[model samples]
Target: MAKITASVYTSHVPAIGAAIDLGKTQEPYWQPLFAGYDFSKEWEKAQKPDVVFLVFNDHATAFSLDMIPTFAIGTAAEYQPADEGWGPRPVPAVHGHPALAAHIAQSVIQDDFDLTIVNKMDVDHGLTVPLSLMFGQPPQSDYRWPCKVIPFAVNVVQYPVPSGNRCFQLGKAIRKAIESFDEDLNVQIWGTGGMSHQLQGPRAGLINKEWDNRFLDRLIAEPAELAKVPHIEYVREAGSEGIELVMWLIARGAMADVAGGPAPKVVYRFFHVPASNTAVGHLILENQPA
Candidate 1:
């Protein structure tokens, strides 16, 4: 049977991707930010999985005001990198695991969580940046991402988005779906976006280091309690975009501990500020083997 080996959390800042693509990672401004992911890159190579269940929000790229799915899952055979105003980044296209993805969709929907099944769509930086940070740039000669990815997008851009509690419950349903799959596969769920930096209006460059750190601590030690936090608090304290943190709860909810198993092992944790216009945070938590 398939198993969810771990959950990864991080902020997907576009500028970080630009720095890597432009060969500016070693520069003074970006060096520290990239350094934080050095361990994650190596750790990813060691704990390589057959597929990555990536959770992120599309920033007005694929889904705009025309159509919005509160929760969308990509079951396509492949996904292209999107052109988010500044053109597409020089990155490998993402391959998808269709069989497993279809299974997850069926299982999740039967469990009562509505999901839009996308067969064709372009993936934005929210999805690609996380891949680059954790896997680094692929060689020019061979430019395929390390593993097949299943993109799970949430609608945080629009109002009436899924609450933290709803996302958490859906994750539990995802765990159940993965475990039920008959294939012998390894999977990792990643929650990307957020660490408290606003990018709009007069508060264009707001950063709350204190609130971000406390949130991280609670996420590691008491995620269930953290899930109870309301949307207004995230907006008021962390900023509007800070609501992205709710996606992290989905990944956290799929862990073993949430299902009456042993607590996950925190393999790595990192936090940094001013990555473009956001505070970057990254974490790697491995489920304790049963």
Candidate 2:
């Protein structure tokens, strides 16, 4: 049966994508940020997952204010990158795992988590940036992403977003669903978006390094406690947009340690500041054998 091999967490900053696309990664301003991912790219190569279950929030690209699903699962056979003001990023189209995604939806829904099943949607930078960071540039990697993907989008753009505890619980259900699959597949679940930076209003360009690093430390050691962190704290301390960090709990909850299995091995942990007004945080936790 299929099993979750690992959980990954990262900030999906759009400017990082711009730097990679415009051939400015080597520039002084962007060099430090991209360098942090050097080890991550190598790690991805060594741990070639058969499929990646990516959790990210749409940036008004796929779903506008008109309609938003708190939790949406993409069960499409293929996904095209959406044009976010600019033309679409020059990246390979994403091939999805329809069977596994559908199974997960059916199982998770039965588990009491409501999910909107999306058959067709154009993915935005929220999805592609993480892919590019992990798989490298389209030319350097492949015309297609290295592995199949299952896009799981969480709603963080609007008010009344999901709570950290809710996202975390859904993740456990996801783990259960994935493991029940008959296929002997290795899957990696990823939660993308945030390390604290408010995009608009008076707090624009806000960066609470102290809170952000503390958040990381707690996330690695005491996630359940971290999940209890209130939403107002994220807004007041980290910045309004920092609330996105709750999404990380979803991936953390899917790990082995959270399920009474052996603690996951932290293969990588990286944090860098001022990556296009946001702090970039990343982690790779590999589930250990029981």
Candidate 3:
């Protein structure tokens, strides 16, 4: 059966994608931010999984306010990069694992998670930025991404988004679904988005480092309890956009420790700020053997 080997979490800041595409990563302002992910790039090369089930929120590129699905999963054979205003990032098209994606959709829906099965859609920076962070810039000769990517988009843009606990529970269902697959594949689930920083209103450019670090701490050690966190706290403490962190709970709930197995090893943890006025948080947890 297929096994979920690890869960990766990070903030999918669009500006970071621009930094890479515009050849500005080495600029002093962006160097520190890129440096934080240096370990992640190296780690990816050594521990490349066959597939990555990435969770992110589509930023008005794929789904607008007119039609927003709380949860959507990409089941297409491949996805084109979305052209968000200033042309699409010069990134490779994302290939999907249709067979496994279909299986997961079947299993998760049977488990009572109402997921919108997306047969086709353009992937924006929310999905591509995380890929660029983990795998780095694709070479000029060949620009394909390192692994097959399965996009799982959550609705954090509009009101009435799923609660942290709900996402956590969904993660449990996803793990169960993946484990039941017959293929002997190594899979990784990635949750992208959030640290803090609101885009509009009077309190724009908010960065609660204290609160963000506390979130990372609780997420690592007390996920079940952390799942109980209410949405208001995320808004008051970490800013409205901070609610994106709940998506991380989805990845966390899929870890072995959450399901009465061995605790995962914390391979890497990073926190940085002010990337397009947002705090960037990242983590990697590798599941341990029974």
Candidate 1 off by > 4 Å = none
Q: Regarding lDDT, does 1 or 3 come out ahead?
A: 3
Better TM-score candidate (2, 3): 3
Candidate 2 residue-pair clash tally: 0
* Model 3 residue 253 distance off true place after TM-score fit, in angstroms: 0.8
lDDT of 2: 0.92
Q: Candidate order by TM-score, highest to lowest?
A: 3, 1, 2
Evaluate residue 98 in candidate 1 and report its C-alpha lDDT on the 0 to 100 scale. 93
In model 2, what lDDT does residue 198 have?
94
Predicted candidate 2 versus true structure: per-residue lDDT over 1-290, tens digit per residue: 99999999999999999999999999999999889898989888898899999999999988999999999999999999999999999898899999999999999999999999999999999999999898787564347898999999999889999998998888899999999999999999999999899989998999999998898888889888889888899999888889889889999999879889888888898899999899999999999999
Error of 3 at 240 (Å): 1.1
Weakest 10 consecutive residues of candidate 3 by summed lDDT? 137-146
Of the two candidates 1 and 2, the one with more favorable lDDT, higher being better, is 1
lDDT agreement of model 3 with the native: 0.94
TM-score for model 3? 0.99
Best by lDDT: 3
lDDT by residue for model 3 (1-290), tens? 88999999999999999999999999999999999999999999998799999999999999999999999999999999999999999999999999999999999999999999999999999999999999997998888998899999999999999999999999999999999999999999999999888988999988999999999999989999999999999999989899999999999999889999988999999998789899999999999999
